[model samples]
Structure formats: structure tokens, C-alpha cells
Target: MILGRDEANKALRAQHGQRGTQARRAAAASVIGTTIEWYDFFLYNTAAALIFPAVFFPESSSYAGAMQSFATYAVGFAARPVGAAIFGYWGDRIGRKTTLIITLLLMGIASGVIGVLPGTDSIGIVAPIMLVVLRLIQGIAVGGEWSGSVLLAMEWGDQRKRGLLASFAQMGVPMGLVLGTGGMTLLSALLPAESFTSWGWRIPFLASLVLVAVGLVIRLRILETPMFAAVVAERRTSSKPVTDAVKHHWREILLSAGLRFSEQMPFYLFTSFVLVYAVEERDLSKTFVLNAVLVAAAIELATIPLFSRLSDSIGRKRVYLSGAILVGALAFPYFAVLKDGSALAIFLIVIASMIPHAMQYGPQAALIGESFPTHLRYGGAGLGYQLASVFAGGPAPLLATWLLHSTGTPFSISAYIVFSAVVTVVCVIVLPDRSRADITDDNVYARTPGKHRTSS
Candidate 1:
């Protein structure tokens, strides 16, 4: 049957509306999935700083116990690269939606188990060992989560607006920090100190089951990204995405990880190490330091997307380098203000500190993910991004704790932050800005420098 012109126009408009709705839903799913995953992940960081040292290592000295707790925390980061390799393969082979679902379930299950696991006083040496194992699982799950979530969000929409769309997934980090830290603060405040140490910390972990459920519902509703669909249709999917990425895109993989040093290293310093500094070194209340972190994270939620949108107009490198440079600039002052400032002054400093990190983190998703073609993006981006956990973030707190004790000043730690910033600056300069590149190009083996395209 032949349709009228008006009917054809109406159907076209309806189809466009449906596509927009699908894009929005995919983006929302990315944000919620990452938020839930990071919520469970960062909650362990909070526990390591406040509860695990005492609960799982009861026989050790205060400093030693803290060190052990942080070691286990680092173990989670160490597991992320493995998760990246495993999930990145499935993401390329099967699809983004399915891979993401498995990661969410893995994370939620690990967290819930940690909540019920017996502590050292009850289970002896096995407690800390088991904690390490569970933390490892959490790390691997999140390792896969970042690139998949960002790709899910970015691929569903216009590739030109990738900076903003990717930032939707990036927002999950700060939002997770806020939710995890804020929940801990409120519970610790309400419960008796002993009770909080005993059981309050477990509440968030157990609640992750519910949050993960919500995330699954959102994620399951979305279809695979259009770009991935094309990859499958063209028979471009790889059985060994990571192996190929390392063999072919090794330079980008290394540069991507180097680019993360300033962002990830100093981020751990500002959030996790700084918490240790406030409570252990400066004798600040856990609640006070936590509140400061919660506030900083809340502020980041607004600023992260703003900077990401700004990158769409300017460029990724300028916004990113500015943030890297500031990481060095603020390294020392961040400690000084926390040590000597009045309540209002310290609050301001804590809140002011993370804007630079946000500047990098917001644009980072698109900048890194843009480095490779659609088919290889999952493996290449995931490996490069998660590798930073091994060298930068995973050891930050442990190193900071040692520096504080041995050097008797925060300056040593400040110098370390500056060094990382310098390394990142070099990487940002070397890595091509693919902000304007055609990442949707399905040519996985293109020889052209930054952007990929099929030869006519």
C-alpha cells in the first residue's frame, strides 16, 4: 500500500524520537551501573581506612594494621587489569550489554559476601586472606566496568558529542564517592563507635545487592550500541581483542596508562590517602574528614560534566593538561591546609582540591576511548585505563603512609604527586587528540595516524 506524504513524515519523526529515547536510556544505564559498581568498590576503601585495620588485623600495631588493610585495598586494584582482559574479550565477542551485566553481578556478589565474612577476631589469619581475595574480585569487576560503561553511553549517541556522553559514565566515580562516603558518615554518626566498627560498615555492602538489582534492570533494557552491531555485521569482532591491541596498539595502550597517572594517582592521594592523613597524621575526626570528602565528591558531580562539555568546544588536551598541572600545584598546599586551617578554611580547601581531577576525569573517558577503532576500543581502552591501578592508584596510600612515618613531613608525598603530574603532562603532549576523529570508523587496522577510515 502507498502511504501519504504526511504519514511518511510522521513515521520518520516517530522513529527519530525512539532513537533519542534509546540513547538517553543507554546513557542513564551507564551512569547507574558505574555508580553502583564504584559505590561497592569505594566502600571497601572507606572500610580499609577505618574498620578493616582493627577488625581484621587485631594483633598488629596501629601503623602495621593500617598498612595491611591498604595492601588488601591495593589488591582490588591489582585485579582490575585481569577483569579488563576477561570482560573486554566478551565485550568485543558477545556484546557490551551482556559483558556489563556480568560485571555488575560479580561486584554486587563480592560486596555482599564481604559484608558477612568473619573478621580476624573470629576467623583468625584466614580473615585478612579472604578479604584480599574478595577485594581482588571487586577490582577485576570494576576494571571491566569503566570502558564498557563509557562505550555503552558514547556509542549510543552522536560520536561528535562523545565528550559529554562519555562524561555521563565518568560522573559515576564522584557520585560513587559521595554515596559511599556519605552513607558511611551518616551510619558512623548514628551508631555507637563500637557498633559501627562491628556491623555498620557492612550495611552498604549488603545494600549493594539492591543497587545492583536496579542497575541490572536498567542495563538489560538497553540494546547493544549501533557501532558494535555494525562490528558484528561486518564480521569484525575479535576473539583476542587484548592480544591484538597489545600487538598493534601497544603505543596507545602505554600512552593511555601514562596519561592516567596524574589523574588516578593524585585522585587516590586526594581522596583515600588524604583521609588517612587527616585522621592518623593530623588527629582529625574520621567523620570530619569523611564529610569533607563527601562534599568534594558532590561538587565534582557538577564540575565533571561542565569540564567535559567544555572539551567538546575547546579540545581534550588543553582541559586535561590544565588539570594535570594543577595536580602538581595543589600537592603541597592540599596538605598544609588540611593540617593548619580553621574549620571553614579546611572545608574550603577540601572542596577546592578536586576540580582539577574533575577536569581530567570528565574528558578522560572520551580521550582514551577515542584512541582506538570501535572494534578494538573495549580491549585497548580497558587495558590501558585499568593498568594505572597497578602503578598509580593501588600503591598511593601505602606509599603515602610510609612517607608520612619515615620523612615526618607531607612534602615527600607532595613531590611524588608532582612527579606523576609531570609524567602525565608528557603523555598528554605525545598522545594525539582524537576529539575530532571518526572513532565510529569500522576499519580496525587503518594505518592513518589518529582517525580510522575504510579505504575506498
Candidate 2:
């Protein structure tokens, strides 16, 4: 069924138009799915900061117990890479949609379980252990969730708008953070402290089950991404996707892990650990910190998409690099603002901090997804992202706590975030800008036949 060149061109254009529509749809799904996953994740983090120590690990000293609870919080991050490997393989081999759905369900069940689980007073030694177990499941589920959702959005989008679309997916983080914190804040305010501690926390976790169901329904309506479908139809699925990702894309993986180090570390520091730091170190009320976070997260929700769209006109690297540099410079100032303990100062600092965070976070998904090929894209991105959980996301809160306790100076924490930004700056300089690269065809596997090495 040969056609004229003009006819072929026309057909290609039509296909591209359809792909554009699909990309938009996929991006919407990615945003929704990621929001649900992070809502559950952030709710736990908020609880850990405000309530978990007393509720889950009741026997230790107040400070020791909080540290212990945070340690358990880190356990999920430790298990992330393992989950990434397991689900990432399935995402690449079977389908991104299927793997995403499975991850969402896993996270929903874990969150729901946490909502209903008996506390240490009721279950004694078994309660914290169960909490840790559920956290591990969450780590695994969410480890795979981000890569799948981002890849779906990136694969469907045009090269020019990839950053914008990808950022939309990433925007889910701030959105989820806002929702999670807002829900807790509302509950905390409405219920008396006694009732809030006793039962209000459970409402947010239970609410996740309903959100997950909504996410599942929206996701089920969308078709598998055209790019992944093409891979399946051509029988190009990697039999050893994880190994191939490691052997071929190891450098990208390392760079990505390092690139993520700055963002995730500072993020948890600012959002999760800051609540405890403010209350314990600065003597500010919990409500003040929560309100500050809510303001920051709200600003981020609006700024993330704006920056992502801006990256489409400018380049991804330029936007991301600027963010890295900005955060590096502002790390010290941000903590200094918190030191003042005034509500206005806290609000201003939060807004300022979130701006740079949003700038980097917005384009991050497309940038990372563009680093690998379609066949191993899921495994490659998932492994790179999840591996960072150990050094970056998982250890952030613990390290911040340790730094504060050890140094008694908040600047010590600033130095840690600055170091992460430094690592990211170097990684960004080394990696090529793939904004205009033809990701659909020109990739590591397409260029190298038997041996798989991704060309820069």
C-alpha cells in the first residue's frame, strides 16, 4: 500500500496531531495519578513530624522517639529501589498503564491500612513493625509510580512541549503536598487536640482510598501511550530491561541520581522536617509551620506549571540550571528566615524557597525521561529516580534532624542542601540537552544493536 510522498507527509502530520492530543490526555492522567500517590506519601510525612512519635513509638524519649519515627519514615525510601526494579521491569515489558495502575492500588491499600492500624498502645510491639512494613510497600509503589507517569506524559508529547507536559506531571508533588497538608490542617483546626491526635489523622489516610479510586477511574479511560504501544507492536520490548538500563545507561542513571540529590533533599527538609525544627528548635507553634508550608505549597502549585511552560520556549537545561544556582544561593537565607520565627518572615521565606523549587521541579520529569530510550525508559528512569531515595529523599529528614541536633546551628543544614545543589550543577553541565532530540527513534537501542551504549 505505497502512497505518494505528499500523501505520506499528510498522514504523518495527522498522526502527529493525534499524538499531540494523546499527549495532553496522558499528561492529565500523569498529574492526577502522581497527585494521589504523593497525597498519601506526604500525609505520612506530616504525621511523622507532628504525631507519629507519640502514637507509633510511645516508649522512647520525646526527641528519641521522633527520631525513631523519622527513621521508620526513611525505611520506605530504602525499599524504593527494590520496588523500582520489580515494577519498572513490568512497566517496560508489559505496559506503563498496567504498572501504574498496580502501583496506585498498592499505595492506596498501604495508606488505607495505615489509617486503620492499631497504635502502639493497642498493639504494643507489633504496631510500629506494621507501620514500617506498610511504609516499605509505599516506598516500592511510589518508587515506580513517578517514572511511569512521567514517561507516559513525555512519550506522548512533542519534543518542544515535552518539558511543559512533563512538568505538569511533576506539579502533582506540590498539589499533593497542598492537599495532604491542607487536609491535616483543616482536621487539626476543627478537632480538639485530643480528638485530632486520637482520630483526626486517620481521616486523611482513609481519604486516600477515595482519591485512588478516582485516579484509577480516570487512568482506565486513557489508552496506552502511542510510543509504548509502538514498542509492543514492533516487539522491541527489552527482555532484560533492568540489566540493559544499568549496563548501557549507567552514567545517565548516576547523573540523574545526583541531579535528584539537591531537589529531594531540600524539599523534605523544607516541607517535612521543618515542622519539627520550628516547634522544637525555634519554639514556634505547629500551626504556624503548617500554615507556612501550606502557603509555600500553594505558591508552588501555580509556579511549577508556569516554569514548565517557560521551559518550552527557553531550553530545559537553562531553566533547570538557573533553579539549581538559585537554590544554592538561597539555602542559607531560607533558614535564616526561619530563625526569626515571625509569621511574616516564615511566610516570605517559604514563598521564596518554593519559587526556586518549582522552577527546578517543573522541568525535571521531562529532562530525566529524555535521558533514556523507550524500551528501557521505564526501568532506566525508575531505577535512577528510586536509587536516589536512599541518599536523597530517604535520608533527608534523618540527616536534617541529626545536623540540627549535632551542630545546634541551623546553618549546618543549609550546608547540606548547598552540597546537593553543587552535585546537581555538575551533573547538569555534563548531560546533553535532549529537548530537541528525536526520542521516539534516536535512542541508545536504536543506535547500538547488540551492545547498548547511549550516545550523548
Candidate 3:
């Protein structure tokens, strides 16, 4: 049974090639699963802005009801950090794929429940309470989904292509936004206003069930990431991954929270609050705002991948820094265009706003995932990113609405977005250039000689 040296070498090469194929398959599956998860999540946000206030909070004054509904929407974001801490521990200790499957199922069920739930007319006070509960569950599920999916992609990719592969998972954001908004727009057009207000809004939520099934099927076929396997084999899994992340990687966690604050805050402002702002403040039609977002999302689908590729060549920090700076400078100008209340003005603002957003978003997944080690990657990244939702994504729409109502000027809201961008610029400047780091080496936890310890 003894083999020649050439035959042994051939066998080793064949095994390595198979592993590469499996890794690519795993990465692709992760991307698609995250896309489905985000699609459901974004659909809820769109509904909150457009319909939930009328359906669930009918007892309050119109403006008060809108704010209250948005508060429920924020509840999901607030729940995200808590979800990250909980699911992240299991993901880092038990397995990434297992955690992702659970999250996907949880989110799907929560979204489907919302689609079928009776409104206040049928259930009275219990309706809003049930809505809030479902939103919390969705938030928690999504909190774990992003980190697990991104880590799966990053761990499976070649070190040089890590940024590109990880960013593929993030492509879900714009893809989901486009699909959710586009579907709503189409449905809105087909149905009479009364029908849409009565039952048409439920279609998008119900559609999530189909997407969730498809996502589960795709994810079930993929093997676990090689990095997580190595951690398991070495018996180096952290007993408390969340604790370890906080103890050693706290600064990275803080920076990550701040870095995302700018990107996510402005996103909710543009995509969610802007819809309400246009319809109520500018007297623009619902279809106009919906179509504008669809166009912007289409641009994001193309631009996100391009920026991700660009990050591979120029470095993530460089690309991210430029994006933060551009967004900070453009915040006021973007809102200024919206002031005109013309379709052309809305189009210009949407395109301008999303372009900078895409630049930062393109390389974002890899940049965040690269900040942590293999054993703690999912927990660390998830906690950091989800916690940012509290001040960033969760409160953004509410904050924008409050500012506009109080000041009667969009300039106050623009200032809030600009402030977040400034924080991101500072954080990006301090992050290490991971593009040149030896990411494939298993000794990721070992501090490089002369390099200060990085925050998680």
C-alpha cells in the first residue's frame, strides 16, 4: 500500500482543492442566507414608516401614533446587542453555522407572525404589545445573523480576497432594501389605496416565509468554515467568548460601534424617515418616495461590489476614511436638495446620499470581521456591530423626526448625521491596516511584536 512521493503529493493537492471548493460554497451560501434575513428585516422597517402607525397605534394622535410605531421599530434595534451577546456566545463556542440556522428560523417565524397578526381594531391594546414583542425577537435574530454570515464568508476566503468575500455578505443590505421597497411599490400600484391600507401591506411580510425557506435550504448544504473547524480541532474555543471579547478587545468593540454609527444612522434617515418626510413635509406622493428609494438601492447593488474590490487594492481603511469624509461633507447638501420637493431633486439627493453610503458599506463586513480572532470572531463582531444599533440605526429615524418637528428645518437632522460621520472618521484613522496582515496564520490571538493590543 506504500505510495511514491509524487503520488502522496498528488493526494495532498487533491484534498486541498476539495477544501477550497467547499469553502467557496460555504461563503456563497452565507451571502444568500444573510440576504434573505435582511430582506425580512428591511420589509418591517418600511412597513413601520408607512403603515404600522395607522394599524397598531390608532388610539394616538396621527403624529404621536407615527412616533410610537417608530419607537417599536427602534425596539428591534435596541434588542440587537442583547441578541448578539446571547447567540454570539453559542456561535463562538458551539458553531457558527448552527447559530445562523437558528437565527434565520427565528427571524422568519417572527416576520410571518407580524404579517398575520390582527390589528388594534381586532385585538385592541394587545395589538401594539404583540407587535413590539415580535420586533424584539426579529431584532435579536438579526443581531446574530450579520456577524455569523460575515465570519462564515471571511473565514472561508483566501486572505487576499477576504475583504471582497466578506463584503458579499453585506450586499444583502441593499439587495434586501431593493426587494422589499420594490415589492411594496409594485403592490401599492396594483391595489387600490383602501385595499393597500386594509390588507396589501401584509404581502411583503408573508413573502418572507418563502425567502426564509430558500435560505435555510441553501445554508444546510454548506460545510462549516475552515477557521471555525481549526478552532474546534485545537480545543481553543473560549468558555465565554463574549467575556473574552470584552476583556481583550474592548477598544475594537468601541471603535466598531462608533464606526458603524455614521453609516447606519444616515441610512435609516435616508431610507426610512425620508419616506415619511417626503410624504408629510414636502407633500410628495408615497409612490414618488418609494420609486426614488428603489432607484437608489439599484445603484447600491452595483456600487457595493465595486467598492469592495477597490478596498482589496487600496486598503479598507483608506476607502472607509474617504467615504466617512465625503458623507460628512455631503450631509447638508443632500438635505438641501430634498428641500426643493421636486422629483428631480429627490433623485439627485438619493443618488448622492447612497453613493457615499455604498463606499463605506462595500468593505464594511471584512473590516469588522478582520478585527477579531477566529475563536471570538463571531461574538466580538456581532456584539460590536449590533450594539451600535442603539445609538445609530435604532434611534436615527426617531431622532430625525424629532429634530424636524421641533426645529421645522431639516438642517438639524443633517447635523446629527454629520456628527456620526465625524466619529467614524476618527475611528477609521485609528484602525490598523489589516490588508497586509497575515490573516491566514492560525496564531491570530498572539500580539505582533511591537504592536499594541487592539480593542475588539
Give the per-residue lDDT digits (tens) of candidate 2, residues 3-82. 12343243245445576566667888999999999999999999999989989887898779879989999999998898
State the C-alpha lDDT per candidate.
0.86, 0.84, 0.83
lDDT for each residue of candidate 3 in 1-456, tens digit (9 for 90 to 100)? 111234334433433676677667767777788888888888888889888888998778867977998999999999999999988888887677778899999999999999999999998989899999999999999998989998877776777887788887888888888888988898888999889978999999999999999988888876666676665654566777788888888888888888886789999888999889888878888888999998898898889889988998989988888888888888888888788746788877886788888888888888888888876788888988898899899999988888988998999988998899889998888766677576645355454222322222
**Model 2, residue 321: C-alpha shift (Å):** 1.2
Question: In model 2, which runs have C-alpha deviations exceeding 4 angstroms?
Answer: 1-21, 443-456
Model 3 vs. true fold: TM: 0.93
- Candidate with top lDDT is 1
Query: What is residue 402's positional error in candidate 1, in angstroms?
Result: 0.9
lDDT string for model 1 (1-456, tens) is 111234334333433566688788889999999999999988999989999988999888998988998999999999999999988877776778889999999999999999999999898899888899999899989999999999988988877788999999998999889999888999999999999999989999899999999999999887777777766655556666677778778888899999999999888877887777788766888899899889999999999999999999899999999999998899889778877877677778888889999999999999999987777788889999999999999999999888888998888888999999999999999998989877876443354234322211
Ranking by lDDT: 1, 2, 3
Q: What count of clashes does model 2 give? A: 0
